[model samples]
Target chain A: MHLSTSIWVWIAAFFTLAIFSFLYKDNPFYRFAESVFVGSSAAFAFLNLWFFDVKPKLWDPIAKGNILYVIIPLILSILMLTRFIPKIKWLSRWAIAFTVGMGAGLGITGMIQGYLVPQLKGTFLPLWVPGNLATTVNNWLLVFGTIFTITYFYFSKPIKGKFGVAAKIGIIFIMVAFGASFGYTIMARVSLLIGRVYFLLHTWLGMV
Target chain B: MKREIPLLITFIAGFLIVVALFIPHPPFNKIEETFNSWYIIVAGFTFILGIDSLILHNWEKIRRRSEGWPFALTVILSFFITLIWGIVSGVRTGHIFSTNSTFRNYFYLYIYVPLQATMFAILSFFIASAAYRAFRARTLNATLLLLTASIVMLGRVPLGNVALIPVISIAVLMLLWVLVDELKYVTSPTQRLIYIGIAVVAVVAAFPITKFLYHNLSPVTDWIMNVPQMAAKRGLFIGLALGGIAVSLRIILGIEQSYMS
Candidate 1:
């Protein structure tokens, strides 16, 4: 039982245990740890934003007398704070309008280029390869799977007979895919568990 | 006038961004980049709103001596401690009132990281407990899902694959046999023909040599992932893209003003 002599390790271990104590039941220790976590993270984000973004990009440039480009965004940012004032809250809508407009615009182009075009291009697989039977079969399955899955989500008309069968096949494919995703998710969570355990054993107790 | 102006702004911004994608002209190309820079500036300033909300909520709790008011106090203390430490110590080094690294590293590493990690790690236990209850095979679809999930989970870990290898080999052999046998019983001529072709292919692939090839659970899981999972994901991506474009259009056309409210 070679426990860590370092106070930092002890502190980390205590907090880790405090959080894990929620499994037994939520307690003051857990609440204290959770509060500290939330506060510190919020503070960290604030500091990082100020230092990395506002300081370098907005503040320094304006301070250096490069005010022409920075002025519009500065005004927009101050306008955003008008949300706090009840009478002037409507003024903040302009800032929201600008940001949301820009976001929507960028999002549309991004979705087309990044997702729509690429995914459409991906569906164009050659079903009949000369020698590669496995590859050929896989491609055929993929094409049918994609078509049927998309058809399942089609809501304009009633699905019956062939379309119904196709949708059923699509459901099967979706279920299997969901199952695979669930398994992977479980693995991810378990990996986090392994990490915490490793920290406790190796870092705190020297028990690796 | 207020509503119309914002809608017009949305239209102009969205249209220009979309148009900028095709235009190679320097000014048009810079529009998106300029918008992005403004977004960052606006987003950076909005952090104050979030901090103010947190402070107000916690302060009210503290003032009322509400349930878990001590926790609220801890939150406020930790926030200021971290804020002051980061500001005074230059975020990376120089301590103001104290010279030791205690104020800086202790709060971040000891409290924050451990708390975050342990919080996430606790989910593993909950998921495991949930899985135990959820993985029952009461129907054909449920059984298929369970089987696939079992294969994937087992395939991901070393021990599970070792246990699954022989089981998978047997299952594949059984599937091939079932495909062949089912070919004889179908009524429709077209279905029979398709079944025959599949059976023939399965027979050829079901050779003893193929047993050596699929001696692990990985190939089965990989096949399921590559064929079914990839197809479903692509379908979803396409659907999401279409939906996103529609929403963008709605916002741009002033049909969606819910965001402003």
Candidate 2:
């Protein structure tokens, strides 16, 4: 294995090991690395906010002799920071209201169009398929599972009677789903662990 | 005036988007894109508020020398250093992400990526520890969850047969242990015999079950995922959509005034 001679690679290796130290216990090295990560991420966000959004949308238009077009948003942006001043903090609400409105609008439309429509359509599978026993079974399971799961989540009445049975089955489906997700997450983490280990042995130590 | 004006803005904004969806003409068609641009630009400024909060909180900790103040100082230093580096790099190279920039290569690629990745990667051990604690096989529900998770995990990996054997052995052992544990609750000789008989059967069937699973684990896992798992997930997605729409409708109609606060 060829070791990386780059200083940046060394720095990366150090941080990787530092983070891994947490597996032993919470130590100063881990704490330092965690703090650094938090700080770097914050800095990264600040940089990105400037370069991607503020600069391009607000600054560029003004820079290119179109200040009037973006003036409202610029003013709104400034108004957002008025929260630092307690008396004028109410001014920030206008900016927030706009975002909230957009979010609500997106949520409504996104739900109806993106999820509800497609999911309902997919659940409308043919209950029977000639000589395709596996698919037929799966289709029934899918249709019933969706029904049960939805019923489990939605109810104003007490969870009893015939609905209770369906809801119980829904909870089982939910449990199975959660279990599958947990396993999948563990699999991902294991993959990442392998990657880090490979880096440590191959890149850092040249002992693959 | 403060609350009412904000509510009006929210209603108008939401109304504009909904209107744009139905009427796709000149001003109406372009409204969504224009509004999104304005939102993003304004939203960018909100990051400053967040950064200010983080810095102030950390600064307070540092000033008080509260617990891990040195680490707080480290956070502050790292933040400024990275921020200044990016800004200076952007000034010099016309972009912070330009090729050959230290901010891109040194800080971002090396420092940020590794830190984030390793932090997440360490969750492997934690997840394992958590699974061990939670998955006691004490109840049927817990057993079902544990078995589903184990199979899914095992099927995803190679040389799984080599590892599957030990896992199956552990499962067999656990089965026997549970049976023995049940003996404690036996009210009569019949109950004891029933537990013993089950234990014997489990021991006898362990080999065939293990062999079957070793051969068909992947397909079984696929079936579990494609059928029951997919069905459940689909249900969840539908539920989430309906819930989101309800909440959004509430917010848009001014019934939910939490955002105003």
Candidate 3:
């Protein structure tokens, strides 16, 4: 049987086995692998930001003829690094505030444009479909399911009678949704586990 | 100025972008574009703060000779080593992720991806434990969940529909058993009749349903996903978006000052 001779493949196998070893118990190998994962991930993120975000957005304009335009952001970015200095740490707040504001701004606009509007548009379906029983049923379910789900979250007043019934229906829909989500999440993790196992077998050990 | 400046900055940045949405005029659109770019730059710099914290935390642990300090050292060493190699290689190749770069080919592909995927893969075991906690499988909700989750996981396997029969049986039986047990609390004859009626209906309906599912399990899964899941997801998304917009407005209005601290 052909075995993987590559050192990198061996390294990957070791790390994979090392991580899997945690399933039995946390030991030195597992600890080392875990730490390396953290450290290397951080480094990778650092390199990515520098190359993709910082270099192009911050450094390039300054190096080019657009220094006048980039001066503000440059100053703000430098200010962000001032958190290391205790005396002038407050100055970093300016930069932090900018990011927070931008996030808040994007949150509002994005929610409206990306999520809320589209969802509402999707939900506003005609309950009746001409000569299509399944479509008609699905439209009714969508309309009622959405309305009921929203009613479940409505906490301004005490729910009772018909309203309570609608809220109960909402809870059923929510639980079903959560159940499906849980199943899907577990399946996704299972797929990842399968991929690792496949790599260990076919790539590393040449065992199908 | 410490508090006021941040609050003011958050307000101005948030407010202007929202205004730019409604009025995409020359200055407004330009301001939105500039602010967006600046946001990306500033956010990128925030990673430095994250790395700084990680390094300092591990460094302090190492200095103190804390338990697992060697692992911390491993962290620091790997971080710096990877960082240095990446930067040097980036300088050499004009990019850190160049096709020929060892950082990408060996370290990233071999080391980082394997570690990352393994780490996530390890969670499947934890998720199994979690499923034990989650799916007690007595109530209709739990039974439905168990059935759907099993369907999803096994839907792609050969004879997948064959595998699903037992699961559906178990789930249906558990649900029926739960209803049967609830009869003790139901002193009313009509309520007891309702329970028995449901069980009988379930027992009778199981035949055709199982027949359909024995061949159409994948289609059933697709229907569950497309119809109920999407409907619920849409509802949740709408609610979340509305809530997010409210909070965002509060931040822009400077009422949400928690970020300032």
lDDT-sorted candidate list, best first: 2, 3, 1
* Model 3 ranges off by over 4 Å: B154-158, B172-188
Candidate with better DockQ, 1 vs 3: 3
Which 10 residues in a row give candidate 3 chain B its minimum summed lDDT?
B140-149
Two-chain DockQ for each candidate model: 0.60, 0.73, 0.77
| Tens digits of lDDT, candidate 3, A1-208 | 5799999999999999999999999899999999999998888888988899878886787788788888888899889889888799889989999998999998888888777777788888988889999999988888888888888885666789998998888877777788778778887888999999999999999888
How well docked is model 3, in DockQ terms? 0.77
Give me the runs in candidate 2 sitting further than 4 Å from their true place. A1-3, B23-27, B64-67, B180-184, B187-211
Per-prediction TM-score to the true structure, in the order listed: 0.86, 0.91, 0.94
lDDT of 1 by residue, A1-208 (tens): 7889999899999999999988999899899999998788778777877776777787889999998979888888778889888898888778888888888888998998888888788889998999999889999889988888888875455778887888888888888888888888889999999999999999999988
Local accuracy by lDDT, each model: 0.81, 0.86, 0.86
The whole-model C-alpha lDDT of candidate 2 against the native structure comes to: 0.86
In model 3, which residue pairs have backbone atoms overlapping below 3 Å?
A: none
Write candidate 1's Cα lDDT for B1-261 as tens digits: 778877887788888888888884888888878877888888676566567788789999999999989999989998888888878675445332234555546666676778889989999999999888867766667868777777788877777755665665676677667766877688888998887787567657655534543474577778888899889877776787889999999999889899877
Per-residue error (Å), model 1, residue B198: 19
- Residue-level error in angstroms, candidate 2, position A1: 6.5
